[model samples]
Target: MSRSTSHSFSRSRLAALAVACAAVSGTLATLPAHPAAAADVAIHDIQGATRISPLTGQQVTGVTGVVTGVRTYGSSRGFWFQDTRPDADPATSEGVFVFTSSTPTVKAGDAVTVSATVSEYVPGGASSGNQSLTELTKPTVTVNSSGNPVPVTTVSAASVPSAYAPQGDPAANGSVNKLPLRPRAYALDYYESLEGQNVRVGSSRVVTASDAYGELWVTVKPHENRTKRGGTRYASYEDQNGGRLQIQSLGALDDFPAADVGDVLTGATEGPLDFNQYGGYTLVARELGDLRQSGVERETTRAQKSGELAVATYNVENLDPSDATFDAHAAAIVDHLRSPDIVSLEEIQDNNGAKNDGTVAADATMRKLIDAIVAAGGPRYDWRSIDPENNKDGGEPGGNIRQVFLFNPDRVSFTDRPGGDATTPVGVTSAHGKAALTASPGRVAPGDAAWANSRKPLAGEFTFRGKSVFVIANHFASKGGDQGLTSQYQPPARSSETQRHAQATVVNAFAKDVLKAQPDADVITLGDINDFEFSGTTQRLEAGGGLWSAIKSLPKHERYTYDYQGNSQVLDQILISPSVRAKKAFAYDSVHINSEFHDQISDHDPQVLRFRP
Candidate 1:
């Protein structure tokens, strides 16, 4: 049968057609039909048929399917569901959804009929130019489940699947493999500990979720099918398996009490939360304590003058194309980057060794910054990054945009020597959206010909005050806009949410491996995470993994390192162990703009931290 007809097949039933139709079929053809032309509808007349376009904002009704999901609005409700027509494509047709004052009885898997008003989606649509949905509605449904209707809590840590098995022996397989770029050892260990534990979590932010390995995080959430496969069975079967969250846990949201989405939280009494390039919001556990009526306990503040250990991050405002003024820019950049023992730099250019100047360029801007660092004075700085030369891109090609760290060699030393292979660096996508490598400068990975052309992340181990600190530098895909998704009928362009999570997962894997090598290892992850503390990326990276955000331990003034178009956020950050933060091991800030006279050399300001170790 043609692929279009194959939509009826379930996951287990598609084994034969999977290989036969691989080359014949493109995307399946069961997408939603053009919306209905009318503005209003009679609720009694459309009980069994699929509901398309309705009067733009008029109340309409139909008994189609159960309210499989209900998104509550303080007083009203919203959700989607399957149509009652057996021959109709429930996967493609607008399932029943509702926006009303009543909190309808709906969970992810349970299905019944819903009575909702018909309406067209709101304004913005399309990704990479493909048609997208803004809004759809269903009225209500009859609850068939036992007792009272059990609400499907937005998949959180508190819910555990029945088949869950604790991940023992770090080598054991997890729900998914995280990307192998800069690994997050502590984060991975903590996630492994909760392999089978039941926990409560929230849909903190909408982001691409990935597994422990550097791959996509796939799980089933009722009617929602994330695997991109056709038919509802896949989601139905996997829903039994449960949805997957990242290894990094950013603590509970109750700690910060962010009233709305996209809020940046800092210094909750609960300790630290992890942030990432993907999305998700998070706060520390200590902060959660403060939310209680009893108030926070054991709170302490330190003097800033006592030689604090520092770390900072910045988005170098298109820090590419090496020009003479670039050095002045680099110095100015560093001046703003300031005194953290480590600094994360984003948007650094990469050359695939095929340069017009007859030089094998890594990221020219990164190279120039390192040269400037040496010129300013050596030994105060030393850096390690990954630059694999991809032979596919011509020899005179350019490298990718990437994230790198500039560490004080006098304070930190390398631990993992680059093993001749392409070490999974930190990034998941290049500045322009290519899956390439972007390293600062240092030893090249063995057999990594593509590193020269890509903007992937580069990672390494270091020592400070005789203590080990593993630094994982990353720059996630940007969500600047959806212009990249402007296509007529093409599959949707990769969402920044998903790609960023992929990169975050890659770092999570690196962390897990590190802990496997050293169970009691002391690690610190600091960089330009490209996300806010309360976002999904941060939550998964912190809650799933064990990485901690230093912002939770610091005062608010130092919470954010970059301000764009009035959006003050903590994109650059430093996440350390609870033990380290307790000892006051570091301090950081959104420097340069805050402390210097520089006219914002880059989009991100510098940060500083000081510590004995």
Candidate 2:
């Protein structure tokens, strides 16, 4: 979630506009005088057929409309007006944003006419390739009357485009961000055409739960590929699912409805189309529809069957002793995820936890977590890990987050060996007709450039039911610099995946070496891979069929372990080797204790897999 740091409109003009446009009664009094040569201009004519305003850089006179909404605060000090009379073409919207640079004097239901210069304002300046918003700047307002009904246009399911964006210039390899608008065909184009228009979205389903910022994302098309939880899935690259729209209530924050994923919005929600930095095109709702809960609840704890070795992976989101969320996290692991025999824990911060004074030991942090788990009715689990060099790992500065292992002593035992450290690489060796690690809990290819400034994979040797199994815990590079879905560049750039791909290559190679040494080696590579199951990083890891994602055993909609913008995407995965995949006794479940709820202990949900070795 992002906050608006800068004003959407000019701040300099705000004070003057506020003083000139004081609150007035319903009666039309002290109307501003108009010029003798004022020519009537329709809102649609000014909007034009394309995204760029046709009458830009020119002064237009005698623009008339009924005020549909008013924004009194923020940099976008303006009132939205819709034309009482609309155009025949559905592509052109009959509304416009009049920038007053201060508190809007006009109120909803007021009939008004204005003479102003048509200007196109590009947020973040000209260097930003973002779409420009059309506005009437430096305006003189005249109140014709009050209590006039505002015109509203309904956006039906058929109006929503199926395609997300237009095919940019092929010569530029889609790098050319700007392209001509196709309002009829593309989703972005269709929304841009209705920018600043008073529109109604009817009977929409909530795809994203409301965030801390009081924002919700909904889909108007009910026929889209939807999850059982009521969220529309990003099923394929071809289906963009243009029905999605962001809902923003700029009114009193308390008035904004609290909604969750799978909720339904009944009746029509009336709002003016707004384009901003956080989300491309949002509906600034003046009247919200009724919210209906769809009875979606968090999943229960997974069951572990007899003669099965249960393993799980969870990203604890920088857990530390100082953080107050440890107890809840422990309860989630014990009560909700069913306490797997061996669990890969990621983002375990240093002992001090965010105190930048160069403390790297996490014994205190780990002990506190283990104690809490025991108090929560879980087994006494022993742990193994190697501390990273001070501040070398990339994460919250001073946090020094790394991966650690927790194994139930009653069910499993660590096969401890020598020569494991932060910089040394772990290798595979044949022992007793089985594949084993040189060091029981050793780092994998730590000196490789691919592991620089990132958490190194921790490989551990464990024995369960007289059988040896190896588990590699990894925390890959985060998606920090990836372009947002609403980015000006079509098919937004995923630059962060480059490092993750390199990391995946090294891990995959290590897994293959173990398989080569012992054909039936039970190697389980699991942790917060920080990429989607269908992503290129996952494909690279499973390229040679060395590892198989256990999450694939479930249905497509049930594969998510993280939620972003209301889309449940996979970030944490438990991938098993062919020896585990070939067996038909494997069972996998994504225990959903956190991601969907508001008071989440971590951003990611835990994944548990049970298999017989």
Candidate 3:
């Protein structure tokens, strides 16, 4: 995150934000004594039955409601108030957020008449593709009375629609912003209808663990695409978990209990429905339910048999020699992952990680990890990799993070050919119907623009039990600039994928070249692909039957190595050539040691595959 992170917004929207900022610059002020009369409307009618408000950008004078919730904390200080009398239509929400942008004089249960301008304030800005939040901005309030009864709508499992989102109007360019709310049909529309309303959810299962930001995710549909590890698996774009809801407290997070996945929040969890950028719609709870521990535990994969060759991929999250997680990572590799014959470690930083000094060597880092693995009762692993140019790879500055191969010398012998360097391109050479690497432990197309500012794939050749095997470890471009799933742009655009697709194309071409050299070539390409197996990147890599992601072999519910915002999905993968997949004896397991746990050594769970070569 750069300090100068900026977004380009339309002049009109920029002016609106400027006016909003100026409205509540210092303190709260009451309504004007003499004001021009304007058309009065109910809160639901103001909210309308569409994604966008019907009275957007209009000045409304008379609005009466009871303050259901007040948020005096944070920069966006305001209160949620609801009309005591709701309209007959269930599609329109009865509540709205008063964007004071500062501390308010009113409290919950205070009945008041508000004169304010209706504004559609997009949470993360319109350019972020987030849906606009209907708010009463630059308001003038006159208190009528106190201790008024506020309505609390109970939202049970039956209330949430089975459908996730609406099919956007094709004319509107697949944006549901202009679509009418279908409260009984679509979940997004249903939540949009209840935006800012006081609601309560019955006992729910915690899907995402509590984070440092004092937030947790719970699902009303507890059994929806659930994983054995007690998480909701995000299978595909069309099959997303609809019941997932983010939960936050109005009060201090210190009072909120820490919880893991599968933990239960017993009883009713009441809050005001609000839409934000972090995770789309959220429940800002005023009273939190008591947490019931679920007793979740880490998982270990079965060790490889004597005749089998085990290969694993793990993203250590920028590990260096001095990090405290070395012991834990070593143990995870040795005990949980069961000490595979070869491990592809991503994000292995240079010695003295992130230091600006021109020290690009990572021998110290590798030695430290190897020593820890040995201490943890694992093999003395020999390693091979190319040190990336300083800051050339897209990782922490000066860290020079790159993919590395840690192989047990006792189990496998590296086919070390000459002339392998950081800037050299590794190629395939065919002789006597056998395929061999031009350079051992070499980079694939180091000078190609596809790998610009990204980790280049490291290709290594080894002989396992007199059978030659080629492995290409890749850590492709990340998904930083892509639009999120809840974006106003339906089926949000993945802008960062252009580079990943190019990278995948390059690696796939290289693998195809090897397969062309020998049709039965045993080639394995694996690492942090940074995209799902169902995505175009994966398809590009699996093009022409060059390689197949072994993760697909597992059951749909068990096909996740990373969890992002409670969606158990895949990022790391181990792909095998058709020759290896053709073998009858092949097993894959994603060791669940990290992602699900709050205290994680790495954000990714290590995946291992064993096969007779």
Best by TM-score: 3
Q: In model 3, which runs have C-alpha deviations exceeding 4 angstroms?
A: 1-27, 30-39
lDDT by residue (tens digit), candidate 2, 1-613: 0000000011332331221121212122227534323438888888877667889889888888888888776556788887877777766778888877656778888888878878777654444445567778777778777887778877867987777787656765553234656777888888877878888999888887775555688888876777666777665445557788888775766777777778888898888887765556778888999998886777766667668999999888888888998788888888888889999998899999889989988999999999999999998789999999988887877988899999999988999999999988899898777788999799999988887788999999999989989899998888765655655666767777899899999999999999998989998999988887888889989979999888889898777787665466778898899999988989999887766665566778888989998
Q: What digit string (tens of lDDT, one per residue) describes model 3 on residues 1-613? A: 0100000011231221121122333335654334323438889888998878889989887888888888776667788899988889888999998878767888888877887888787776667778878888888887777898778988767888888888767887778898888889988888888998998898898888776666788999888999997899988878778788988777776887688888989998887898877778888888888999899988989999998999999888888887999999999999999999999998899999989687788999999999999999999999999888888887778888888999999999898898788899999999999998999999999999999988999999988999999999988888776666677767777788899899999999999999999999899999998888898999999988779999999999898877776688888889999989999799999888877876767778889999998
The backbone clash count of each candidate, in order, is 130, 1, 0
Evaluation by lDDT, superior candidate among 2 and 3: 3
* Model 2 per-residue lDDT at 38: 42
Q: Sorted by lDDT, highest first, which candidate order results?
A: 3, 2, 1
lDDT of 2 at 347: 88
lDDT of 3 at 107: 80
Error of 2 at 354 (Å): 3.1
lDDT pick, better of 1 and 2:
2
lDDT of 1 by residue, 4-94 (tens): 0100011221221111011111111112323323323322232222112324445554343433333333222334443333333211222
Highest-scoring model, lDDT: 3
Alpha-carbon TM-score of each model against the true structure: 0.42, 0.88, 0.92
Between prediction 1 and prediction 3, the one with superior TM-score is 3
